[model samples]
Target: MGTKWITFDLDETIMQNPFGKWVFPEIVNMLKKETDTEEDILDLIVSEHLQRMSEERFLEAYDWDDIITGVAGNLGAGSVIDIERMVIKHSESPKIYLLEDNMLDYLKRIKEKGFHLAAATNGYSKYQLPVLQKLGLDRVFDEVITSDSAGFAKPNPAVLKKLSDDGEITAHVGDRIDHDVLLANKLGVFSVFIHRALPAEVLAYPIDERATHPSFIKICEEKWHKENRLREMPFLENECIPKVVVQSVEELAEKIGFILK
Candidate 1:
């Protein structure tokens, strides 16, 4: 291969979603004024959301808009027009943090070593691009490919294959085994799985008896969805296993350097 490249997954791998937890709360507040009791409305919406998540095929067919529409239907709420606008606004300007300290510096060092970097993620450019710009990584990657732009999502090798078009992809790093590792293994690229601890906000969020129950919170935490996908998918025994596993992004940086050397 003439040039070596490394690809990174965006959401949980490079950035933490602090804004995610607030999305439900914002939706609840928007609908609260329509109902006589605010707490009752919140609890009802949470319950409806939990019911949908508990379904067998939820993970495979999950869509936020659909979930919100169901919630509105269940509550007999007037219209989802305002709710849709709110969701789009929140999605466009997500408040996020780097998963590791000095992540930008680490990526810069990797670039200095002459390795092309690409961001292969399963989101729209409108949403993912803003997060990159906020992280000051707007110009970091040689290519920023998303599901909307690529017409393929993770666990489908085509997403990663796009990066391989310009050069050989030496490794792919991400937080999900089902999506990220599976595709990398299929493509014969080194798969590095980075495990991030759940954020304190997620762990410490008060678990109310109804609205913010454990099951409801579980669906809210994206990490839970990742783990659930691993369990649900059939490739865990063979095809989806990662070549290396690290607890933090700092450790991932160290492992990447050692592996490439």
Candidate 2:
């Protein structure tokens, strides 16, 4: 089969939406209660959380609980419970927004090449669908399938299989190497990894802590969660790496061998 269908990962693959805006400031204020807690220290903690989200090795050494525990350090800080509560609250109900506007033109270009487009994301309808609507992409995407709708998440094989049951030449495009690429590769479908711009918050985050200003965070959350799942499933190998990797969508058409008008 040729490339007749294209599936995308929503959060960072196309859009960069961060949840828990309250998390950073709240943690900073609480940290100051236990110790002098310079903004630099809080920035370090924020950077750690981000690294934990992106890098598997960093996550293995520390998690959200570890970060908080390191902060309080046996002072019996009552704020621990409050902080955990805050994380849980915002994490469950994230503040979703569209960070990239260029995906529309990219999707339109692919669609014009006679390929159907679908969004296969591991997010909730309440949150994910609204972002698409806000970006005016709700109608543009042929179908939107989320974890809530799919009853399975990525790397599950079931999610990709469900999409393939429709019998179309499918190509999966996402930012995460482990999640989108692994899933597509597992299913023997053409996979493309689009290295979208990193969030500004991540790039501008304090010095040395950041690799570079991400030119791009829930996107980060999704990465962390996906990494955790991959870790748990040790048997799963990334046997199928992406066939192509492009920095932007404009470069996607030729890379994927799709011709646009």
Clashing pairs in 1: none
After superposition, which runs of candidate 2 have C-alpha atoms over 4 Å from their true positions?
1-3, 18-101, 197-240, 258-261
Shift of residue 103 alpha carbon in model 1, Å: 0.9
Clashes of 2: 6
Model 1 TM-score (2 dp) = 0.69
Compare the candidates by TM-score and give the number of the best one.
1
lDDT of 1 by residue, 147-251 (tens): 767777776787666667767988888877666877788998887766555445533543211213343234324444445543443333345546655556665
- How well does model 2 score by local distance difference test? 0.60
Writing each residue's lDDT as its tens digit, candidate 2 over 116-228 gives: 88888776565466557756678778888876567666655677565577767467888776668777888777777665564556545542233223222234435545555
Candidate 1 colliding pairs, count: 0
Instruction: Tell me which residue pairs clash in candidate 2.
Output: 198-216, 199-216, 200-216, 203-213, 203-214, 217-220
**What value does the lDDT take at residue 248 in candidate 1?**
63
